[model samples]
Target: MLKTWQRCTSCCLGNKHKGDFMHIYAIGDLHLSGEPPTKPMEIFGEHWRGHKEKIRQHWLETVKADDTVIICGDISWAMSLEEAAQDLDWLAQLPGRKLLLRGNHDYWWTSLAKMQKRFGEHFEFLQNGCIMVDNIAVCGTRGWLLPSAEAFSAEDEKIYRREAIRLELSLQAAAKQKPAAIIAAFHYPPLFARTEHTAFTNLLHNYGVQHCLYGHLHGENHISAFEGLREGIRYKLVSCDTQGFQLYKII
Candidate 1:
């Protein structure tokens, strides 16, 4: 169950007070495979057995067609775009406009133009870019593992720096729009379990981002993820399992 602070009353179904307000919600690490799931996440835990239905039910109950849902990453298990069609179609049938960030497991992801053309306007992919949601700007990239991680290698450092540049580019683009607020999303946590800060967190702070949402941590690793207010910015982990497969309202 969600704590009181994590719950939003304004976005519930049939709420008369919700007039003209477009709510934004987030959840990530969907790990969906086509209908006959080739990669059942149940192997991770029994809690994932019927996750798709759980997500759909909660989503329908929370999000409206005009609302926006940001999916942080690991959206599908398919190895290629052609193989991911079924999974993509499943998401298309869900309510709300979705903004997707690439996950490490999302090998099916190709160029942004190809994905945009294939999916149309309903699904927007974020990669070194920002999307305007009402007066707010949503910006992000597939953040890599922090250098502080014990397993970090030379190659990991290369990817980490590249992702940092991408994040800066996205933030710069969002800054240009001068939106009322900025929200940064990522597939990997910006900081390590014990580390206080990293390049990713610094970029966020420099850009004056208000909230940061990320996933990728799961099961026993959940305890290590950092959350709550830090340097005036709020960070939250939105992995599907962590949220009990429900969409978290983010204003």
Candidate 2:
């Protein structure tokens, strides 16, 4: 076990010698619409007006080709791969290496193989997977609400367990990469509320993951979103609107 961990540590340290140090950024819930059927986000609230432009400007000003960005999901408003390509086209022009996870509203997200074939390498999709940059490993899944949630049902519980398993798969993948640190991203907040503990949080503890980034909640729902340190892990809500449409610097 120690030898395996050491190998990972060495791999992480070795990655830093590639010229310049890497900068990592994370944000979520982009909710971008595509093509002629563009869906206006302003309907959700005043904050979403021109959200795409806001994200573009912020990304241009903040990230570089050498930097890494994690989009925690709800990326596009498209209903199929064909439409999603337009959004992907715009995202490809942006600077930095990007890892995009899925959100509830991401109907266009299809098979990873199909997406890779279509977008090439413009971005990586995180579904029961992970990515590493220098010493930081990013792992994520579309988390689900716990059984304790007010609206939790038998069906919700079933999906919740599946999501938890996916989260574990992602974390395990990151662990094998042997990163010095782990940052977990989720489309849904891990916990139903700040004070509530769940299987997702337990997994973070088991894996020694130090930070968690998430989105999905918006407007008044932000009040229940978890933030700050809990059980040795730091949680951050990176919803674009919540973070003022700016990328949250993770390192």
Q: For each candidate in the order shown, give its overall lDDT on alpha carbons.
A: 0.87, 0.84
**CA RMSD of each candidate after superposition:** 5.5, 3.1
What TM value does model 2 have? 0.91
Candidate 1 residues 1-251, lDDT tens each?
11112223344322533477788899999999988889898999999999999999999999999899999999998998889889999899998999999999999999887898889766999988899987678999999988777899999999999999999999889878766678899999997554477888888888888889999999989898888888867899999999999998888
lDDT of 2 at 71: 94
What stretches of model 1 exceed 4 Å from their correct place?
1-19, 193-195
What TM-score would each prediction reach against the true structure? 0.91, 0.91
Clashes of each: 0, 0
- Choose the strongest candidate by lDDT: 1
lDDT of 2: 0.84
